[model samples]
Target: MNNVMGIALSGMRVAQQGVQVAAHNVANLATPDAQRLQLKRSAVEQGGVQASVTPAGVDAAAQLGDLLAAKAEVVAFAANATVIRRQDQMLGSLLDREA
Candidate 1:
């Protein structure tokens, strides 16, 4: 329950970070000195995942692809959250029935 929610929340956080990085890359397209950034995610030792920002090159096609990927990540995060909500609801219903 808590573990599942934690994983979903971590995924949402990473997705948000990805979206921010993509938007930043798109916004700074014209800045010559700007260093394109990317969000990297890694699984934590305890559970969930964590995100980090790393330097990336400014390539138009790659940036576009990153935007699309971020969009997909958002959708995935939403789905994960939904699963957690549904699981929580089911647990509540079960507890109510038991009571």
Candidate 2:
């Protein structure tokens, strides 16, 4: 196909973007409030972001969206966890005191 080089080059660019996005995610992984992000790509026909055969999952843009969703979940869990943990600890203390 005449578009092979174009495809190859496009794939490289997407891969580069993926690497950068992954690095960004790694940078924030340690942060409790931080989230990971990446874009999604596909070798789709008609204006598709050409990608290699690796299923082209989790590109930078998609990653951002995922990050937000994950953060929301984390926030929810953190809220519940904190309250539950504190309640459990307080209950334990009360029981110990009574005993």
Find the candidate with the highest lDDT and give its number. Answer: 1
- What is each predicted model's overall lDDT from 0 to 1? 0.83, 0.53
Instruction: Please give the TM-score that candidate 2 achieves against the real structure.
Output: 0.42
Q: Candidate 2 local accuracy as lDDT? A: 0.53
Cα deviation of 66 in candidate 1 (Å)? Answer: 2.4
Cα lDDT of model 1 overall?
Answer: 0.83
The TM-score leader among the candidates is 1
Which segments of model 2 are wrong by more than 4 Å?
Answer: 46-99
**Candidate 2 structure quality by residue, lDDT tens digits, 36-79:** 55456676574325433232343456545545644553454455
Per-residue lDDT of 1-99 in model 1, one digit per residue for the tens?
A: 777888878878887888888888878778889888888789988688999999986575976687787788779778878978887998899999999
Candidate 2 differs from the real structure by a C-alpha RMSD in angstroms, to one decimal, of 19.7
